[model samples]
Target chain A: MTVSDPTVGELSEGEILARILARLSPSRALLGPGDDAAVIAAPSGRFVATVDTLVHGPDFRLAWSNGFDLGWKAAAVNLADVAAMGARPTALLVALAMPDATRASFVEHIADGLRAACEALAPGCAVEGGDLTVSDTLVVAVTALGVLDAAAVTRSGARPGDIIAIAGDTGVAARGLDLLFSHFTDASGTPIAISPAALRSLSDEDGTALSRQLRPFPPVALGPAAASAGASAMMDVSDGLVLDASRMAVASTVTLDFDRQCVGDDPLSLSGGEDHALLATFPPSAVLPEGFRAVGAVRDVGAAPVTIDGEPYDGESGWDPYRDWDSARG
Target chain B: MTVSDPTVGELSEGEILARILARLSPSRALLGPGDDAAVIAAPSGRFVATVDTLVHGPDFRLAWSNGFDLGWKAAAVNLADVAAMGARPTALLVALAMPDATRASFVEHIADGLRAACEALAPGCAVEGGDLTVSDTLVVAVTALGVLDAAAVTRSGARPGDIIAIAGDTGVAARGLDLLFSHFTDASGTPIAISPAALRSLSDEDGTALSRQLRPFPPVALGPAAASAGASAMMDVSDGLVLDASRMAVASTVTLDFDRQCVGDDPLSLSGGEDHALLATFPPSAVLPEGFRAVGAVRDVGAAPVTIDGEPYDGESGWDPYRDWDSARG
Candidate 1:
């Protein structure tokens, strides 16, 4: 069926499930959906589990994102968290809550997006199982399971004199979000409906930035590689470079110093969120992994947890979901 | 803090999480909360995973249930799914979404309910980690992980001539729900406000039924016991008995025949939902485990997937969440 066809309210739960499951192919699960539970092989003897939820109003706007984008972002964000733990994602369990009036094809497109993300970002990771329920708003909750191939690279492992490095893009998603906000809203900050054709006609640079926002490319492979390479500590740069670095510093009881010259003209690289880049600290003398670029250094425990270019950064730390909507808009 | 003190909007996400985490005591997970992901031991080399979502309007009503009740019910339902698989629950991951106006005390109570359930029902099980997000309505999504100690019992293992038995309450939750519905609504089906004191004054029998509806105690241990006892097939009766039995019959390619006398006076036993009982089929000569009572027998594949007393029995099958709201209310 096409994307605009039959609404889910017109079909039974069993039928919708059958259609969605048919579109998914699980490669890593011992036993996939259709059972009471899915069996996932955990040969490493330990499983790393993380869960994240995306709500429609706070996380995404239906006008700005389609089912495919929603599904892809959901998978990418969770997979990034799994990668940050220095593990390889093995399976994903999705629990979706949507209004009954949602189109059946929308759900199918979501499945397709999940499959595409798995194939592109973390091959062999499967959509093991999921639950679907009716709600007034759309909510996608993903619980990702991974296997630790090496010692877990926790945020608490950073030590004094460690060199900080990063893998994948930083601040791109934040830029994309800014562009979308501008394109969809009028001068007074009120939302104005924009046609799909108009959105497609935007400048190529804007289109590229929007894609980054809609579909982040987290460095899933580099996580385990860094872990194996003896990285001291690691985490995904989700909230923002400066804010997340502060978190790592506090966890490790050390101080993080980011070089302003290395961060470049993009102030966003220091404060933008949703980049999903791998941020790791390696021993000062250790050889850096291939994809990672040196951006900062770990210093001895100091008065402040994080600083930029030897001085404290006095700017917005990062995005906070609980902030008032008006303040968030600014 | 008391149950009615502070609203969640008064605190930042970090503050809320810190408060919630302080109340949780995790015994089964290798790592619980505070990191990118929680680590769960999977000594069996495999993990059984299941997820369920409870939406405010569709799955529950704040007018009738409290935060503690919501949390307890969420944990119980997911744990029951793990138990149905003949596995022991090891860890739980929660993804909660709610409006900004939600009370901090309410969230705390939910966490308390989750902790209480793990302590009381499945000792040693832990709330390993979770995600909290802002939404327009309340949604609780839980993903439970279990370890199979013995052979994993599936619904597709029943053979012809196997005796059908069940271990736990039947139709009680449905009856309890009916009682609650009748109490809160006028004869014309319009909602009428019922005071908490009046609700507390319900007859002992009615109170028992309501508790079953609000806090189901699934026969978790019996599932593993049935597996050890060499039961041929097993499943949880989450839906009504006939509908779920039909599912088992279809999976095993056998016909299930229930004796009317065995089910007794509660016709709801044959067609009610949320019982969370372990239903299994075993060889006729095998001794029934304690708590399991014979209810039927497995037969060769026939015209219909299920029958009662050697003849087809026609009645309303069971609950369907996707059914129209009015019909579902009935």
Candidate 2:
């Protein structure tokens, strides 16, 4: 039966898209609606592609999070993936599905968020195309395509004794999340004395942290730079320093040693996601480029897994979807 | 508040991706997860791209349309888009968002539908990457990429005095849709009985029609063929013949004349929505390719809009999203 309005809620994803497209400017876009597929001219032959999904509740608290961040995060995560691959993002395709009752404003803000993220990361990157539908759940999926000018750098070329370096700060984004959770809880619990000054500080901190959490500044150029500089292996510091280091080790079949003390207090580095920072392994003697911070060293793959200062430390690794979250729903 | 499921849906998109990477055969994909983006080696540099969106209720009736068709349709529409661009689809990125309560089987079956469509049109094209979110509505967004060994054709290249042609039948898909509506009279009357024999005939008619409707088969090879043959301009017939022709005329600043008698019994030509046959204008001296029917002629810009037999007949030009629907819900 065609219940135009399923009791579940508002407008179907298609309805929202129809509205979005009506006002959306696709002038910069090579091809728009009414075609089988949209065509974007990527002058650069080498294109980078990345995709990500955002589920309800787990990834976002609708109460605290607005439609904007949701859209921004969706694009940001995928863009980050492309950047980590050392590519300049060119276009994005976003897919969103929701109930029929969803407010038109929500969809608009989501589009705004996507626009903001695109402008921030890749100024000209536009929403080339995507799919939208109606489902029982609220899920946002985005796939971003990028262009690599020089060459694409992978994560499997680190040579032993290479210096492990990172661009951008660490951990602050994670700390900001802690603050956000506290604010959410406090706002939900008992209204705290949130002064304007305190709020301003929180806002500033959150801007930095949220940027790291929402739209990471992936070293898109750094990847090619590292590659050109004879970087053995390279990757984005997504999960955590120690955890991601281990990934390089495994991918390169080399042991990774992290100098725990060298791990900077850059909140963007620790627990920071969406930082879009690039981490790479260079020969110990190689001169680091600006923004590079030597955090650890690559070692030989021997009897043990990755370690901190020659010892296996009992600590949490990077974010694990299955083990870290109770639910991945936004 | 984060609701932890710790089960299948609990993992973040990245986390789930990591797990998927561990299970997937790496050889099939040049690059897997954990990088900024995945690099898919398109043995050929030329690729096809298409996109389509599916909304709930309006596009489908859950009672009559199963998850299979839903999934199949999502991929088919985009593939058709790619084909329309004169590219053989090779891969697809599926973006699905639904409520948290959506059953896992529903998602799996949707993937199955995509596989089925891929197998039917061009094997090896599968859901490469996508996004998922917990939306209030169900939205399925798909972007498909294809490949072309020869030249890439576009709508801007049609020239004056070119012969207008189309591949495959048209409008049958729209007729089948009419039959569907006739079968189920807005859920107000008795549903018609579809006999087995009649069903078989209908299946053939519908298969071709449905393929046109649900899964469009674009004459991708003809794109380069037309281009190499010095086609003035090219495009796929998406909006009705009249509307799409109008588009070509506007783009090329030319008037197109069609001999209605030359147009056979293919309902799609007159009034079809998804019959993804290739429509191109070639030099008068150019020989028509296989499966393509010379339906009309291109004229220099004149006062009249695209006409049939030198006259504008009053009928539905094509589908208009806002006007076609019976109503809109906030």
Candidate 3:
């Protein structure tokens, strides 16, 4: 809208990339961004890699999230996946597809958010290489790579007597999502910005929930700590505690039972998503890591993969991208 | 269309993933798709990584390309970047964002295409991990990782006297694109399928051009071979010889002078894009790699980064996603 901030359509790819590189932290890779491909040191002789994508309509609404929050959340989610494998993230490759009409400043903000998230949540992790292309939709696809200091803590290693634990906030992001749907949309379900008066009047819990939804800061450092302390199975809780736990249980050929009191008997706590909490199973005699707290215990193969208080309690099963996305509302 | 081939929206994410995995090659990484992230071997202590994305509208037209072609092109483009670094691609992380109504069978074909490209171009590379999300527009974002046995080749390492060469076709794919625009579109410029009669009537060169555009099979293994043969600098020619050579020249602080006859005097050969050719500079005394052919030579920094027979040549400069995309046309 201003003379200084041009739409991307007015510039060249080189100019936009230069602008982005200027905002990012200096590369610490063996070879960095100016080249066709970046070379990163794989110190452990192996590297953990994963990719996650954030699409404009289905993942977030511009009314609720700014460029900064979107970028930070994107990096946080993928970094959590790497952390869940007991690795310290070292590099990121970001592929961004945006409409040509998008502003250069907005893109710079996204770059800043990526750098900030890496510095605050996963130290020494910097974006090493990336691609930019024009698209009808705005998409951020990030690949996070890490070097493991210990054996990867997979979801298939749990035993019958292991204690199930969780690190970082659970259900809070779901509640934040709940508030947005309840208060931030118009009658036809179009998102509108949260009003200043409403922001001022929200409860402390509501404020925290809203913040969690917009910019989740998962406990990244505790993953390796849990692994070092002898976690048998581990995974990030993105699709709610129950849904992700069932996956772990199925992989391990065991049953997972959570105490209703410890996991918060609320449906959202059991089925909420986007929290990026690290969930792990530790042996009976193991001391829980500093950020982890025992929430339940693993059991022998039962009728169901997950149970609550000795029963097959059911609520929302959390997000299944194909089943949950309502294009009309999105 | 049938009970066995339901739309992806009718299935859970797990079901869709299982279907895709079944269509892909067996996993070769230390850990694969079932985990939070995959662990891949980095035998050389260094890994090359890069990401590229193709969006439906600006990147391709469904009427013109099927799911298989889409997947193959995505993998081929990213693989070329890794090869350009003088490394052998080992793994790919694919992030696919598609419409909810997309058919499950279509997704499977995409997986098959990805597998086929990797198998043909880089024998050991496989899809190790990926993310699937729902979007209004179809986007395929691929991240490729590789290991280097020789010192990683970079575009900045080219010397003034180095010989410039290319290992793949330049203007052929561009001609393929031109043909589609000229013959495959309706009066209003909307893409329509290539008619059977039109397909049957095409000449051999035109047919090859069409195939090149749809499913590019870049010289993946030759990148390392070029390096082994003492290539001083290397990069993939995605955006055309003139434009990409200009980049290498700038990065090396040198100028590139091309023999128009060797590189083809056609403007498209110099300015068109999406070729995925391996372009490199080698010591004048070094024997050219098997697949490579001399096209130019590096010179001291001159008025223009790129020249034709020692003179500044002007034509189309090649694609700048930000500047070239016409949203209305897309």
lDDT of each: 0.85, 0.63, 0.92
Residues A1-330 of candidate 1: C-alpha lDDT, one tens digit per residue: 654477777777888898888778755688788778888888888889999988987788887788888889999999998999889999999998988889998999899888888889889898988998888889999999999976688899999889999999888898888887878877876555557797789888777778888888899988889888889999988888888889999999999998888776476777898879999999988888899999889998788888878888888778667764432453
**Candidate 3 chain B minimal-lDDT segment of 10 residues:** B1-10
Where does model 1 exceed 4 Å of error?
Answer: A1-4, A186-201, A324-330, B1-4, B186-196, B324-330
Fnat by candidate, in order: 0.81, 0.44, 0.96
- The residue-by-residue lDDT of candidate 2 on B173-259, one tens digit each, is 676666666653445643344444545666566655543554455554555556556566677675577767777777777888888
Write down the DockQ of candidate 1. Answer: 0.79
**Using lDDT as the measure, which candidate wins?**
3
Query: Of all true interface contacts, what fraction is found in model 2?
Result: 0.44
**Predicted complex 3: CAPRI docking category:** high
Interface root mean square deviation per prediction: 1.1, 5.0, 0.8
Taking the candidates in order, what DockQ does each have?
0.79, 0.28, 0.89
Candidate 3 lDDT, A119-195, residue by residue in tens: 99999999999999988789999999999888899999999999999999889999999999988999988899977
Instruction: Answer with 2 or 3, whichever has the higher TM-score.
Output: 3
Candidate 3 C-alpha lDDT tens digits along B88-186: 999999999999889998999899999999999999899999999998889999999999998899999889999999999888899999999988999
Q: Which model, 2 or 3, shows the larger lDDT?
A: 3
Which one wins on TM-score? 3
Q: Each model's RMSD to truth, in Å?
A: 2.4, 6.7, 1.4
